[model samples]
Target: MNAVLRVAALGLGQLVAIGLLLFVSAGTVDYWQAWLFLAVFAVTAWLPSIYLQITNPVVLQRRMKSGPVAEGRTVQKIVMLGLYGSLVAICVVGGLDHRFGWSAVPAALCVIGSALAGAGLVVTVLVAIQNTYASTTVRVEAGQHVVSTGLYGLVRHPMYTGNVLILVGLPLAVGSFWALAFVMPGIAVLATRIHDEEKLLGDELDGYREYTQKVRSRLIPYMW
Candidate 1:
């Protein structure tokens, strides 16, 4: 599909998915937090998507890919499934929290969460702009090279850095403090995925090993 059409499809899919998920989980449409959360999530996600479509439609198309990486490793595939599953769980739990008043997340926290998600989206777009080979699946693309500039200079996995930030912000945005616990395991799984990515890059992409040495950090600066 074309880039514009792809973006439109994805955006529509998100609205439908979020609307259904929230309705199913919360059992009502009266939850203001869910509405706010969806708005923030949709706007942030689509803004970057549109930017990528304009600047690098090829990368956006690659990001839309659905399949295994080069190795087609089953374990990694399971981890990917688990990650997606956890994302769904997050919304469900958040809806339950809102329905039952499980946790009284303050308005301030929700605002902060929205800001963090926005920041994460910005970082993600920046990573995509810098690294043309940053596909959704973990693999070394044809003619792909290590991107040591911009955010990569600080963290080896800057795209994942954005993901980490989003994970932290999501629970609060959805009005579920307890859902934060769910984000941690996903982060750990992503760490393993990053390990697999780097291993592949070091073997297949020249200079990646050297870049890793220089950066030292994978998803966080001056740490990890």
Candidate 2:
């Protein structure tokens, strides 16, 4: 299949799946917050893919080949599973929170969450534009080198930084404080994945070790 077509299919499928998960768990279509969250998510998620497809098809192609099955390392596979599971859990819990009125998140907070999520999406897109070798799966591809400019200069794993924001912001955007509880596990999994990825990059990719030293941060600046 063509990479563009594959990416489109995968993106559409994921969008539908998330919609179903949220609505089905919510047991009603009257959830305005869920609708708003989905709209924001769809735009942020798909627009970046389209941009990447136009500017860097290789990155999009690599991203399409993601999830646990695409991971070569056992630890990476486990991390991917945990990450995906947490994402699903967040959606489900958010929906359930709405169904049961678990928590009443303010409209202002929902707007803030949407903004944070959008910012994270932009950050991820910027990372992809700057680092052509930014594959979703953790592996040092052929001719792949450490990227230390732009966002990479700020942190060794800017992509993961974006991911953390998205994971944390999504639940709040959906108006589910209960769903926010799942974000921590996803972050822990991401941190573990980053650790393993750094080990691999340091061992296989040249100059990665020096890049880490120069950057001095993995996902956050002035901390960690």
Candidate 3:
């Protein structure tokens, strides 16, 4: 099967699973804003993959393993998924609570979280446009060349940075402390992956060391 087909299958499966669970068990819905936020998010997250599958299957097919390609370490991948799950759980539970007229602390987190998640997703789309992914392992193609302009000019791994933003934003949007638990571990995993990924690029990828020198920051602006 092609990359587009594979991605479509996965995306569809996730949608179906989540939809069924929410409908059959949870039977809950958030505010209209939450639904709108989720719609935008789902589209942004999957649209790029769909585009890449059609436009650049080579990047999608070149995986580190016979599975989905992640930009960083495998452990980080699991952690990110966990964090995202927490975000969803928070949304579902919080939405339920809100519907039941339960009180929540720090009301501002809802608005802030939505903004962060939405903004982070926009960044994610931009990174998707700039970076290429493969099926086996992380790599940039021979002619793909490192990007040192735009967002890359400041951070070596803007995608990781964006990922963190969304990871934290999801739980914040739902206003749940339980969902926030994954942030620290997620950050730790991302840090390790960034370090290891840079080391790998320094060794395997051409001119990546110099790129790092020029960028000066891994995930932040003007700082390490």
Candidate 4:
């Protein structure tokens, strides 16, 4: 398929995935927060993908790639699936929490979380803009290099950082306090993935070791 078509298909697939996640979690199809989640994800994910498609189709296509790389990285993929499970858990738990009134998440808190989620989405777009080799997988691409500017100047893995915010914010935003508990597994998985990614980059990608020395933090600023 063409680049535009590919991006469209990806967007549609994500929307379906989000819907299914919420349905399985909540056991209903008319949930408001689920709709909100769909809208938020659509806006956050597609805007950047569209921009990348227009301004940098090659990079956009690279981000869309999905195939197995070399061996010895199966653990990361499994953990990544576990992370995705956590996300589905977040969706499901959020739905169940909403349905069963398990969480008294205030409307104000939900609004605030939504705002943070939106901001995190914007950061995701920035990550794509700054880092050309920002693939979903953990392997260094052919033309990958150190991106030490913008958010990368602050953290070595800004994409993952933004994702954490996205996943964390989604639960509260969707009125899922119990689901918030499930977020830790996803956080642990992502945190470990960052270490693995950095190790690979440090070993393979040029200037990454020096970049790590300068950045000194992986996810959090001045803490991690």
Candidate 5:
């Protein structure tokens, strides 16, 4: 398949997954504006990477064809996907609750939730800008070298940090205790992914261990 088509297919598949969760949780409830924003997030996150990968297939191919750094613990991937699915489900349910006037969220909580969600999104943007060249897949490019600068100068995995921010913020956007509860699982998945990623990097990437020693943390500043 053409790379664009292949990526578009993946994008559609993601949409289907999210859509199923929305259907199951909302039971025919539709909130156009909120859904539109959700779609916006999807496009913003996925589209640029899709275009980059399509335009730079050789870079992607090199990464994929490269030897495994280690046996990746795909359990983290599954758990993360599940958390993302649950975010969609909770958002759908929250929308339904609001539509039917079943929402119990106080106005103060709404403000707090929106603030958290916005902060999370802002963090994601910062990380993306910091590591603009990192691959979407687990592959090393021909010219790709370990990045130990920018955000990497502080933490070994700013992208994972951003992921945690976004995932935690997602529940806040939904504005419910049930949605907020999902953040714990999201954090667990992030922790697992970070561990797995570090294992691979330490084993495969040159100087990564030294880099880690210098940084000393995955997310926090001066403290893990």
Candidate 6:
């Protein structure tokens, strides 16, 4: 019960932190686009976390220990730092764009972006549901095995695919086309992390090499 409460509090803290970053950087609370984006993001991100907490507490517990400090490998620590920095830049840049009138995204496009973000988060939750060992850090846990069914069958790194969508969608949802530039760094970090993670998985985890052969793609199908 305490673990569940801690997870809930942490989730709420992150949400509030993001909101503060957006509004504080924007210099005002009049940004309706940011509000709508936050609403969509909060629902899509939090509800699934709550459900996962109930259904798969172990994965949730593992995920709770995230960010660079939780990463075991030095390379993964760097990758996580880069990834987190880029995510922060996305929010900060988006808010600044709003404050300076840098980009005038249409309401329809913002709605589309919200949908994309929501869908991406849902994909991440589904991946967690299908794979019990989907920890936030890039490490194989004790008793971990290759997950080749469901989303894993579609792509070796479905979670990263979902992250890519979220990164792309965040700025547009906040009505800042200029902020989309920040997404590239996050994607690049994800790619680097994937390369390192796959190498580790192939060498350390049993059957992972064969599963990689069967999956064939990391983030996308037929093209990657």
Residue 84 alpha-carbon offset, candidate 3, angstroms: 6.4
Best by TM-score: 6
- 94-178, model 1: which lDDT tens digit per residue? 8888788889999989878867866787787777778888777777767777788899888998888998888888788888998
List of clashing residue pairs for candidate 2 = none
lDDT of 4 by residue, 1-224 (tens): 37777787788888898788777767877777667767877787876786688789877766666433422498677777777788778887787787788889877888777777777888877887787777767787676677899998999888788888888898887887888887788889888888777788889999988887899989989999
Higher-scoring candidate on lDDT, 4 or 5 = 4
Each model's lDDT = 0.79, 0.85, 0.62, 0.78, 0.58, 0.86
Ranking of predictions according to lDDT: 6, 2, 1, 4, 3, 5
Q: Mark the 10 consecutive residues where model 3 has the least summed lDDT.
A: 60-69
Better of 2 and 5 by TM-score: 2
Worst 10 residues of 4 by lDDT: 63-72
lDDT of 3 by residue, 1-224 (tens): 56567888866675565444333333455454455445655676566657767877655445213322354657546644654455456556555544554546475767678678777767766765566542224554556566788788879888777867877776666554555666676667667767766777788777888998888889878767
Looking at model 4, residue 86 earns an lDDT score of 84
Per-residue lDDT over 1-224 for candidate 6, one digit per residue giving the tens place of the 0 to 100 score: 77667767877898899899899999999998888877887788876677678878877776567889999999999999998888788889889999999888999998888888888888887887888898788888789999999999999999889988889888888888888888989999999999999999989999998998898999988767
Candidate 4 residue spans exceeding 4 A from truth: 66-72
Candidate 6 lDDT at 211 equals 90
Q: Give per-model CA RMSD.
A: 2.0, 1.6, 4.4, 2.3, 5.0, 1.2
For residue 100, model 6's alpha carbon misses the true position, in angstroms, by: 1.1
Between the candidate structures 1 and 3, which one is better when assessed by lDDT? Answer: 1
Superior candidate under lDDT, 3 versus 6: 6
Of 1 and 2, which scores higher on lDDT?
2
TM-score winner between candidates 1 and 6: 6
| Residue 116 shift from truth in candidate 5, angstroms | 7.2
Please give, for residues 136-220, the per-residue lDDT of candidate 5 as tens digits: 3343335446777887887777766666666665544544555666667767766766777678778877777888778898876
